[model samples]
Target chain A: MNCEEISELVYDYLNERLDADCAVSFTVHMDGCAECREQVSDLQHTWTGLADLPQEEPSSELKARFYSMLESQQVAAKPRPLATWFQNLAVFPLIPQGLAAGVLLFAGILIGAQIESGENVDELRREVRSLSQRVTLSLLQQDSVSERLRGVRFSYQSAVYDEEVIIALIDAVGYDKSVNVRLAAIDALKPYLSQQPVLNSMVTFLGKERSPLVQVSLIDALFGTNGGETLETLRVMSNDAQVIDSVREHVRTLLEESV
Target chain B: MNVTDVFSDNELMLRVRDGDNVRLGMLFERHHKKLFNFFLHTAGKRQVAEDLVQEVFVRMLKYKHTYRGESGFGPWMYRMARNVRSDQFRKRGNAPFDSANVETVELADERPAPAELLETDQSIGLLRTALAQLPIEKRELLIMARFELLKQDEIASLLDCSVATVKVRIHRAIKELSRIYHQITCEVRA
Candidate 1:
């Protein structure tokens, strides 16, 4: 209740952070002391001002500028002749609607009895399968190995029904010819690292992986493993200092639980 | 909105995940002002605050794919914000605070200043200055607690600290605030 103790309690009292006994004592002290009461009021008022401070709003121009910046940065990363090939294959995303339109046209023609030559009918089927072949062939024919790997990745994340998808992801980890593509594939597959084989392979590689980028991906994969053994590896690798903090924080929580 | 409402933050995040730019637009409309102010209060500079908020959203976009659906979306977004903020301090090469500066609150003021008494409102400058002088960790916790209004457990998760540690830090932070407030008032009067 004296000036020093009461003043110290002023903040905790305002925040409701003091223990019950200390709160009771602080309340009693404030009840009789004019100076202490003023201190409490000032602290409360200061808190109110701090609370009322306004947020910064980005103006319209800034938002547009930032968006343009992002788009330009993405544009800058556009791959070489590979980007041109994508320009060709990119239209494939709209194929469902195109196919639907074609189906509607075919149904109308058939219902109206607008008969075509039998050769024309066979040629249409041939054309459709031919288009499918070219699409698959174009993916295989990409000049950059990474572009083909991306096609594999596309199949991996999107076509889960295919057994080859996850297998491609794992195979990319150790086999992809391009480092960057391998890095992307490994990072992307981190979502499924809990899969026992993925965990087993990542840990096996993490033990002696010299490439920091691959080690980084393995660290991300290790998170799904959930235990001290993984933490032990990260703690030992703390010498890298680069990824140490990222590793250490997880390790810190692990070490805390163990102790 | 209720967390599920069309206007809710979670809905906006879901929209962002689904590639709905208009919903992301609404997310900016809803949170931009509030988040921007959080940095303004914490950094005490509009440009820095604006840059930090912009960087937060940029990082948000960069890491959008990593957002797992397990937690409430608000905490996840703010946790991202907290990381970006701490990363700013680290990049500036400021080391951690000395514990001595943290052990106790300084006492110098209880008397009201004329500027405050006349309007029945305290000078915001005092509080802002006081907050700026606090250690980055303490300032971060207090700004997040005061602005985002997260409870101790949520703050703990956002800071990646224990709940007890959050409680201790926040208690110390508020005490530091009161101390800084008093010091500012004394300096102004003197």
Candidate 2:
């Protein structure tokens, strides 16, 4: 191999990508050429130095964040109860919207009367909570984004900590197609964050959550949480590469203040 | 051996594409460090490199449908990584390398002679500085070819160029790096 040919083949030669005959030719040329030998040696040294550079382990936070994202994404990918209901309902073309509205209105009136009567107050409260949960879930599953936003608002107003309602809100945060709804859902879930399930779900959602607006809100919701999981989630978010700069800075600030 | 360890990256990615996203964690575990270093060397900023690694995985999920079973998963992943790095560059508009932010690897406690250890550390440091000084494209080429150990054809496919072109670029990049390293050494010595 000539000097020009050696130049073109040196990288392959160093990498052992050269065929046997070519390798022999290249080695023979380098053996005869001091300049080529020096060049190859320098390249090899640099290459070896680079190989010797430490392979950094991304903090446990990366694994935490990744698994959290994967979990959250899996959660989001699951068929939501209310959504599935709507999908099943789609098959029944004869279901009247007006009739559905009438049924809800009548139920509201019945619940109001039960409250007015003031008997079996505990039962009435249970019934009210159930109704509120259903309303939130149904609104969250609505075709209209605004309706879903309203559902998030209703969940916050009702302060229903029912597992069903919380799951719906979590779904909205993770799976809602609209960022506005998702942001609102994060806010709605704030009041329930004291509940471990709610806290855990929110932290997981923050793992792979893409919307900067939603991420900031979730981070805000998670502020003041010094629990092991929340702290770790916040730490990961603060250093997370996928997080937007503003959100990362916000988390970093939160983390600093917490310290 | 764990059953998962036996699955190839392409197989795991195929699972990921077909709605088994949890399998992605396996792939992440397998490749995140290498990807991290690739970004770290190329960007010369630890935090940015970290974020780029995450971005690449996120893109893998986002664009998983684009993955073809016929192509090697390494090249596919690196191609996405290249795009992510390019996007970052475009977004930052020629951000300067932050040498101070480059992470120092902890040397193994092999009990080498003190002078030899110091020389090794100094050479590594000088090489890193020279690497940071190279053009981003050259730096990336060297990192992929050397550090990441991506085959030339893999790089060629990743960069959408011929194997010959990739080889020539790798040669030039190493030469440039060597020149820069020697220049820095001279400056330090003087």
Candidate 3:
């Protein structure tokens, strides 16, 4: 490349963005180019000097505020998760033995339901409801349960075509090892996301998780939940000159009612 | 002492994650000075830098769950601070900040002041004024490299760009600074 061409590439060359052959060419030119060498020196000096700039620390009061916030967050998250509670139940020999004994009872109930419409799905729903109620009642008797069970806490919000499938889906979302499975759970939960806890789960997936793929889905969930707020947040991010505004603009468009 | 024994910022952060408040405090103590200095130079004022530094820590705490254990913590914090500073100015309005935190820089700060600056008499007050005039991208490139003492590779990682790009940005920024410095100094001394 000529001097003019090399001059135009000074930034690229210095940054090592140039191919090895081009860089060698550029270095060879630099050995004879006084002005270009000076330019390189100036950039080097400024970058070198920046590291020494002094900074101010957050005040002790501010640190306390941060500390307290973290303390509460940890306290909130430290609970043995709901899944852990259920997983422990899965290992109970007495419960499994009871389930074995209930097999006869379920057979009788299944026979009765099969006589009505042969809908095993409906029968399973009825059985799950009774079992959950019995468990809740037993806890209530022991004075250990939180005692805040809703009348239909175990009832489905929507007329799920396959309650069994949805239960499996929700279970997979909660405990499946793959992030993709959890993301699919978020996707499946979309139509039935009127409840706040499920919506909170969607937000937690998007805002708290580091996986960018999951983040994109979370962004989609945020768009569905509250586009205006999501747009405003993205707008705030877009304000940084260094940030890629095109990404922000794309997010902004998702908030628009046009499409 | 080895670099790790001197002050392991990474270890301190891990301790903070494990709920060691004292280690968090130590992390702050070790980094706050250097971070504040970077903020001061970039912000061109002390209280604003101090406030921004505090905001950075608060944000760090709030987003601790989001830290992916990928990059070293300081670089990540700097990236956060960079985003915060940019967002803050935007929130205030897209107005170009005219007056600096000039009145608020630490009196004890021994870094080169305009009055104390040793340079060509023509460009004495130019570097500061010129630096303030660059677009945020250009200014940030120069500030992180110059005042923060980040190596080119470190800056590349912080900015999530190749070192070549960082080099190019810094080069252009310095050239612009040199031009702006000469212009302002001639004006001030006129």
Candidate 4:
């Protein structure tokens, strides 16, 4: 090793990363070269001096502030439950008894005759499905957690398994701030697990979800969809150290049962 | 082994990205002290260093999705810290190294007899003053390499340069630091 080579490998030598032959060569070169030896020694001293600089401990307020900010952000991200909106609406004055009965009677006669004729039954079903889809999509977008929960319930009940509704429910499963809504969305998606998009979304969301309740529900929902892939995902998740113990244990139990 | 010990920085960061954002507490616990010291050495004020450390963590959360685990979490995090420091300096409309904070020291006509400077507390103080006098980029390189114990390749990744470039810069940085340390030592002796 020449002086230039020593300059190039000096850091490596200092860090002890140079191999045995190169290290020996470096030592031999340094022994013979006073200039290289002084330079290396000076650099080494500077490096050591830097380590002597006192490490200042940050104030306790830093930790307190960080955790408080985290808590606030988590709280802000939570979606409000929709049930509150219904409770507010319940305080409104009731409709007049006679007027309510009259409207109900008129609607009953109109719907009764339509069903009796049965000519537009398929058209009516389509209309109802379209309306339900609209309602489900709208409710899912609401700010109230309960309303989103209703949307998830509406999604499955309407049997309106369109691309838009599936996407909405998939989003709820992945991004909903409320655990109840996410759990409900997972349940709504259970029957559709055989579908590629729904299955893929669930599998992807399963990896991203941190809540043990939601994770366990997702695992249950995905249990038999594509047994091989599901088992593999479960097995990987079962061993994941990031996963909470309860969820991992649940996964392990399921894997053992499958065995 | 403790449960938390089982979780690596990357794993904790990945969890943060995946909506287990509270896991960032663990990352913060592991890195905040070293990061605080890095900022203190670079920024030269305790308050400013604390603010920078806070900003880095906030940015980590904001940009959590961008963490791909391609590099170890240390390099990725220090990269963010560098940006936070740069942005702060930019916002303040000042250079990263404030000349006002650096005390001028005259270079000696000749090298002082190699006293055991590195061994004394007063010499350590002078060394710190020498460090503060270095160009900001070179000071940062030395801090990361020596204090933070970041490897050459890791520093390269953080600086978006190659390992060879990092090596050259580090060598030059240490040489500059040594020159300044000697100058300060002479100033003190005079």
- Which sequence of candidate numbers ranks them by TM-score, best first? 4, 2, 1, 3
Greater lDDT among 2 and 4 belongs to 4
Q: DockQ order of candidates, best first?
A: 4, 2, 1, 3
Native contacts matched by each model: 0.30, 0.61, 0.30, 0.56
Cα deviation of A201, candidate 4, in Å: 37
Give the C-alpha miss distance for residue A90 in model 1, angstroms.
16
- Model 1 chain A is weakest, by summed lDDT over 10 consecutive residues, at A156-165
Residue A22's lDDT within candidate 4 is: 95
DockQ winner between candidates 2 and 4: 4
Tens digit per residue, CA lDDT, model 3, B34-131 = 67666665665566677777788767766766665467776777888888888877887744333343333342333554655455432423455566
Native-to-model Cα distance after best TM-score fit, residue A98 in candidate 3, in Å: 34
RMSD of each predicted structure: 22.0, 19.2, 24.0, 16.2
Tens-place lDDT per residue, model 3, A177-250, is: 55655565556666655545454444443433445555556566666666444555545544545434555455
> Regarding TM-score, does 1 or 2 come out ahead?
2
* Native-interface RMSD of candidate 3: 13.7
Tens digits of per-residue lDDT for model 1, A1-259? 6877775555456667799999888878888988878866866766777676544444455456555544454456444544564475566666787776785576667745533546547656655543443243234325588666655545432423222244445555665566676677677567667665566656555665656667676776685576556766766776556554655465456556655
Tell me the whole-model lDDT of each prediction, alpha carbons only.
Answer: 0.60, 0.76, 0.56, 0.79
lDDT of 4 by residue, A159-253 (tens): 54575577678778888999999999888888878877678778878888899999999998898775666777898999999999999999999
TM-score of each candidate? 0.46, 0.57, 0.45, 0.57
Worst 10 residues of 1 chain B by lDDT: B99-108
Instruction: Choose the strongest candidate by DockQ.
Output: 4
**Model 3's CAPRI class?**
incorrect
